[model samples]
Target: MGQLDGLKTVVTGAGGGIGAAIAVAYAEAGAAVTVVDINGAAAEAVAETCRGHGAAADAIQADCGDLAAIDAMLEQAASAMGGIDVIVNNAGVTRHAFILDLTEADWDRMFRVNAKGVFFCMQGAAKRMKAQGSGRIINIASVAGRGYQSSSNAAYAGTKGAVLAMTYLAAHQLGRFNINVNAICPGVTYTEIVSNLLRDRAAERGVTIEQMKQEAEKSIPIRRGNDPEDVAAMAVFLASPGARNITGQGFNVDGGLINS
Candidate 1:
């Protein structure tokens, strides 16, 4: 049997990028999955991909940053999948601006979606998991959380730092219930988000996107950018029974970008 056989999982931001990859990976590992996204079409698309992989899958569209909406989404997801064994809090947003140029609205928006959204989603999922007496929560954080990066905005880093903090707090609070809480700090993964950043940077540098990407890859010790699937593999491992003894830890999958 597959490692995740008989498991039920919910992945937020499942429409694209790392979230989509995680959802697909979980399904491939023999888990029923719920693909949640703010975009209905995107959620459905990912759900279809999961189903195509022979895993039971459903889609739910909701604003993850809103507590009530997240509750509703989880309810719908759990109902569709029968129950939830794992939750991947992978939804996040970034407002790229220098500290001097950043506004209150920018900071607030980043926290709302990146930090607050993850908190409420984890709370709602933990409630269900607590009742069931077992579950796993894997949050997607970033290397920016660990230190300053010239390319990333300060607000984004701050929000990811909050995610790491939440992971630790949640692990402590939920360990009694057999719930595992962990965070993955990914480096420059080759997702649409990074693609867009590369495109913009290329424009700024008067170079092709490919050239910009190559230049960026040099900074990573791995000598190449990460694929979304690399991080997805970590998420799947963390969600499996093998990782039950591990909790409250932030694993960095950033191609050795931050060696701490």
Candidate 2:
């Protein structure tokens, strides 16, 4: 049997990038997955892929930044999947602006989806998990959260730091309920977010996007940026029985980019 046989998982932002990879990976492990994204079409596409892999999958479109939407999403997802055994709070956004250039709106938008969204999603999932007596929560944070030198802006970093901090607090409070909460700090992954950031940076430096990517690889000790699959693998492990004792921690999937 697969490691996640009979598991029910809900992954926000699963329409693409690392979130999509995680949802597919969970389905491949024999779990039913509810793919949540702001884009209905994208979510449906990912759900189809999961179903193609012979797993039960459903698509739901909801803005994680909206508490009401989050509440509805959880209710629908739980009903669709029977119950939630795992929740991956992978929905996040970043606006590239230095502190000096950053506007209040940018900061607010970043926190709305990145920080506050994570908090509400965790709360909704924890309620169900607590009653079930077991669950896994994986928040997608970034290496920027640790205050490392990154291409992202200060606001982005701040939001991630909040996510990591929330993960720790949630884990501490939920461990007694057999809930495992952890954060994944990915570094320069090849997602659309990074792609856009690289394009902008490349233009600023008068370099090709490919050249910019190569330069980024030099900073990572592994000499390579991460792939979505890299983060997904860790998420799968955290949802498995192997991670029963692991909680209240943040795992870096950054190929040693952030040494600390």
**Top lDDT model:** 2
Write model 1 residue lDDT over 98-137, tens digit each, in one string: 6798898888888998999999999999999999999999
What is the clash count for each candidate, in the order shown? Answer: 1, 0
Off by over 4 Å in 1: none
lDDT of 1: 0.91
93-193: candidate 2 lDDT, tens digit per residue:
98555679989889889999999999999999999999888899999998889987874898899899999999999999999999999999998899999
Give the C-alpha miss distance for residue 158 in model 1, angstroms: 0.2
TM-score of each: 0.97, 0.98
Write down the worst ten-residue block by lDDT for model 2. Answer: 93-102
Structural RMSD, model 1 = 1.1
